[model samples]
Target chain A: MSELLKIENLHVSVGDKELLHGINLTVEKGKVHVIMGVNGAGKSTLMHAIMGNPAYKITKGRILFEGQDITELSVDKRAKLGIFLSFQSPVAVAGITMENFIRTTKTTVSGQQQKVFAFKKLLKERMNNLSMDASYAERYLNDGFSGGERKKSEILQLRLLEPKLALLDETDSGLDVDAVRIVSKNISEYHNENNSILLITHLNQILQLIKPDVVHILIDGQIVREGGAELADEVEQNGFDAYRLAVKGDGNDEA
Target chain B: MKEIAINRLPVLTYRYLKTNDTKILFSAPQVSAAADFSDKTYVTVGAEFPENFEGASSETLAAALAGEKYTITIPSGMQAKLTIEIKLENQHADYAGAYHFLLQKGAKLELVWKLSGTEAAQGSYLASYYELEDAAELKISKLQADLAEATLYDQRFFKLGKAAKADVASAELGGKQVIVHSRGALNGDEAALTERTVYTGTGKQHLDLFYHIDHWGKKTVSLIDGKGALAGEAKKIFRSTLDFHRGCAGSEGEEGDYAIQLSPKAKNISLPLLLCTEDNVAGNHASSAGQVSEEDVYYLMSRGFSWEEARRIIVESLMRPIVDSLETSLQEETLEEIRRKLDAKGE
Candidate 1:
């Protein structure tokens, strides 16, 4: 499979504090890479850093997307390059309707003549898949949406944009069991249809629905261990105690 | 200094006034005021009233009509709508004046004004007295302006015999220095009043909006909604008072909320005052001013919009609901004008 993204020696800081220290990771096309760690393990920070959030400054690193160095690109430019990040907590945007926002996003990304009827039909189909009310497509984007609905809207965007590298940043957070199953189904469908996914999640319940090809244990801003999908089940059953021991035995290489 | 001819007579002038202020004011003098296609009137009032700022209505009318005069009358039981267009393109010339509208018993009136840019120290006053018999309605809207210094002082007194309604809306978008004062009075039972005000300021602009409502009747209802936005070094202060007299039993006065969007280096203050002398009346007020938030920006950006685009969209949407309430033609015109100003600001 072709490689979609490669991050080497990624060092990042939020304000004055460093969040990611000498991080490295790679995701290939048509693969699911699960990033799992305890709380404050910098999973969300790594995703934001990769997506070029201005708040997360990269002090030392290189990010290659589709064989092109994009570490210096702005978030919009990165988005145009087909790099998408589903926010952990999707923010509410008032006034702009969902239809308008989605249409504009598609125009920016694809620039193709949109068939209104066909687009609406497809939106309706995907929304049904995510159990979103049809009227949500007309309502303001994420305004007054329930927690589950907001996450569903994020997945809806992913299904619409079809980005090359989809970074699902805790898309499973704040979702009920039913919502998680539906979102997991949509994520799996996305993997089968197009693009790779780097899901940064703490819950293995969603992992059971959409199996990960590889599971990487991240601790204190560094990947302490890398293994197969079994690694996720092992950590889920045994917790990260052994991994934390391994990270500590290394004499804290980051220090 | 130059000498110009007016009404076939030469007049001495310094620098030059870029606007026909007389013609603009004459076009809309009162509720039924209309431009006289056959006869034109000129009036000008020039007296510095910085301290107490009070002058006679007749004296202010005479200055603008020194060259010519026209009259507009709203008769009993008659309701009329007036549209006035004022355009100014000069500087260094100070324009001052007042216009009067006398509404007879049972009369109703609606007035709308569209103002363009003008030079420094221009002042305006509009006084309307409703001599109502029993039931009457008056609706008014004073819209946009681009001026160096302007004051729109509107004094309205409604003589309510039994039941009357007053609807007042003032929407001002651009100007250098503007002060708008609106006073509404209800003296009859079962009377209703609604007032809506919106203003936007940029650059070194300063705007002051004061609204005073006095209720004297039982079972009176009043509603007020005000909104504002400021950019650059602009500053705005809005003061609103909802007053219920002692004998005004069961009267309800609701203060409108104002939201101000401040760009860098902008300042804003809003004071909504609720005063009640009667124990049975209901009165309340709320106001706020703040900048854009990171989360709002992020929500837009994540969906493929630039920060600038997101900010513009939010601000435009903030006023869209109000603009939608206007007539279709007026809404389109205002939207077009706002677009032009936004483009001028390089947004």
Candidate 2:
């Protein structure tokens, strides 16, 4: 398969402190890649750095998308290029209805004028499929949404935007078993033969639903182990203690 | 000097003057009583106040010089809605008028005033006095626009009887120079007053507003809310004061101002002062002004909006609530105006 995203020796910092130190990875087109790590392993930082979040500064390395360098693009330009990031904790903006926001976004990305009536029909169908309330469209985006509802909202966007590559940060966090099943189903449906995914998650519940082709054990900002999907099962069973020790030059690196 | 300054705004160029040249006509209407103040082209209402109404000297002077006046009364247990359209043809002159109103016991009224006419480089003044009897209610919604070439000066005084309530709301989105001054007093027990305003301006516009509510009766309440948005090089100033007297124990008052400065060149000032001579009273003031954050911009950007479109979304959110408060026909008309205004984004 052809490559979709590649990060070469990426180094990033949050404020005065460095988070990711010379990390490198690549995702093949149409494949789902999973990153498993402990807390403070810089998974979210790497995701933000790749998405051009100004809070996370890239000190070194380059990002290549579909074989072209995009390290200097702003977040919106990157989004226009079809790079999507699902925030772990989406900010609730007051006074912006979901219908207006999503419709405007669809117009901006597709370069087509959206008819409100047709858009509402499409939105209502998608919402019904996701088991979301019809009233969600009229309410302010993420304002007063429950944790599970926010996760569903993220997946709803994921299904609509249909980006070439999606970096989902903790898409399964704060979800019940039923919510996880719904979100995993949506994520699985969103990832097809034409798109790729890099999922940042520590839970095995979502992994069981949407199998990853490649699982990378990221420890201390570096992918210490790259292996098949079985690598995730090993971590779920043995924990990341061995990987934590391996980052300190004790355990052997598995490639 | 401005009555208040936010974010270290520079000293204003226009000085705060205690006087203007707009005169009020004190003569009673030649038209018959009980006539409705409804039609657009004709106005027959006149000042219903006494010839020697002992109150504001400026109001009295404006009344002494006013060429035309209007007054409409709501009898006890009655209600009415008054619509007035102001037309100014003067050049470099100060246009003034006095709208006298009285609400008898248990009466209610909502006065919707629309200001239009000349966009010339002149000054306009409107002075109004309201006397609400026991348990009466009065709401005023003022809409003024399309006068970018003129300066505006408006002042109002209100007296509340026992348990009376007065709600005043104004939307001022016009004129390069505008000033508003309002003062009120609660004379009887448990009276209340609510004053709310929304202002939007672009280009080199200037809007200055002042409000003061004094409490004299026990357990009275007063609230002042200000919302303003500015783009381009426009500037706005808000000054509010809540004073509680010794006999006004258990009174409560609050003042809040929210401002959105879309451009770095825009300026907003808010000063809310609270004075209390009573021991048992609650009063507070809150004010904040700023532009949309890069984070909020990026949040919308991630969905496909450009930086400008994201900013427009945030700015329009501030105007949605005000537009929702209008009547059905006016609401649709106002929404069209707002959509056009949003499309003409500055800053």
Candidate 3:
């Protein structure tokens, strides 16, 4: 199968210390790749590096999207190229209604103004899929929304955007059981419809609902271990002890 | 009685005048005399405006309205919509002066006015006074924009009777200088009043808003919401006050406020005042005036928007409380105007 996204020996730094050190990975089309690690294992940094977040400086790496170098593209350009990231902590924007925000994102990506009725119809359908109330459409985006509601709103955006490659950044980290189920289901639905998925989460519970084709263990800013769906189960039951021990022996290779 | 010192300044610059409309003709002496009101009733709309634009006085009601007269009588309780258009016929300054409007008892008036092509320090004033009988309701709205170089003094005064309600709002979008003063007095029991103003200014613009709510009636209620945004070197000043008279009891007032400063030099001064003399009355005000926070901008930029785009979103969001208040039909048009004016300046 053709690769949808490829990151080669990626080394990212913030100020003086490096967050993501020498990481290499490839996400094939029509596949879900999960990364599991401890709190500071650079799990989220890789996702931000791929999304081209300005704060994360990509010092020594090349990110290829659809076989073309996209290392220097802005976040918006990356998004227009079918890359989406669900933030771990979504910011609340007062006065901008959810409907308008989604519509703006849609039209801006396509450079075409979409009719309100059609956009509303799509929003309603997506919200229903994510178990969100229609009233949420009129309220301002993420303003005064509960934790579960914010997660669901992000999923709703994921489904509406239908990005080719989605970077789910700890979407299931703070969610409760019911919320996890719904978010997982929405991700599964999006993966089924979209081109690829890159799930960045510490908890393996979400992987039970949305199966991952490949599981990678990231430790000390490096992807130390790579395996199939079974890797997620091993980490879920035994934790990152075995993987951390094995990676320490390997002397921290970049990729 | 000592005569109130009144200054009548006539500075006409706009050459545009409506010749086909007989009401626009300059009936200087008549309009000025009509404005000299001691105790009387008068209703005036367009068409009755003076034709001789140059002869009209920009200072007093007599010269501005050109002695134009229209009699409007509302039965005990009635609702009506009034559209005020400041149209120009010629591109000349003689007709480009200030204007005024006043109202009487038992009348409900909803007004919308358009302004444009007013050169440096040139704008009009709609000084209106409303007298309400028992249970009267009035709403005054003004939409000002398209200014070559203009300023607006849209001052409104309201006197409410028993169980009367008044809603005064103005949405000022495109103008060099805009000063809006809306005041209301609830003199009778159960009188209600609401005054809201939204200003979006760019370039070298100045918008001053003064709103006063006087609760002189028992069980009266009032709410004042003010929102504004300043880009470039534009400046905005908001002064809101809620006063509870000695005899008035059981009155309440609350405020919802926000402002976004987009430019480094942009200034916003918000003064919210509450004075309570009656023991049972409650009044409070809260305000914030600052540029879009650096954290918010960073968060937005991290989400794919550039710093400039993020600032635009913050400013746009800051003004949304007001933008969303418009009628559905006028939303797109208002947004278009906003986009045109704001975009030209490249926030």
Candidate with maximal DockQ: 2
Residues B172-251, candidate 3, lDDT per residue (tens digit)? Answer: 88666565656677888998988776677788887766677788999888989987777788877666778888888788
Computed on C-alphas against the true complex, the DockQ of each candidate is 0.38, 0.56, 0.33
> Against the unseen true structure, what C-alpha lDDT does each candidate score?
0.69, 0.77, 0.70
Clashing residue pair totals per candidate (backbone < 3 A)? 7, 6, 27
Candidate 2 chain A: worst-modelled 10 consecutive residues by lDDT: A246-255
Residue-level lDDT of model 1, residues A158-255, one tens digit each, is 99888888899999999999999999999888885347899988899999998899898898898988889998988888887777777778444322
In model 1, pairs of residues that clash are: B42-B64, B42-B65, B43-B63, B43-B64, B43-B65, B44-B63, B44-B64
Candidate 1, which segments miss by more than 4 Å at Cα?
Answer: A112-121, A250-255, B1-112, B117-124, B128-142, B145-170, B185-194, B214-223, B244-263, B277-284, B343-347
RMSD in angstroms between candidate 1 and the native structure over all alpha carbons: 9.0
Instruction: Give the CAPRI class of candidate 3.
Output: acceptable
Q: What TM-scores do the predictions have?
A: 0.76, 0.81, 0.79
| Cα lDDT of model 2 by residue, B1-347, tens digit | 11322111112233453121212223211111121246423234577654433222344335323634666578899877767666544442345666677889999887787665456535555677788999999988777776767666676778999999998877777676776777889888899998888777688887777788889999999999887677889877787888888999889999988888877898877777788889999998999899877777777788777777777777666666665554344555555554555467453
I-RMSD for candidate 1: 1.9
Once model 2 is optimally superposed onto the true structure by TM-score, how far is the C-alpha of residue A188 displaced, in angstroms?
A: 3.4
Ranking of candidates on lDDT, top first = 2, 3, 1
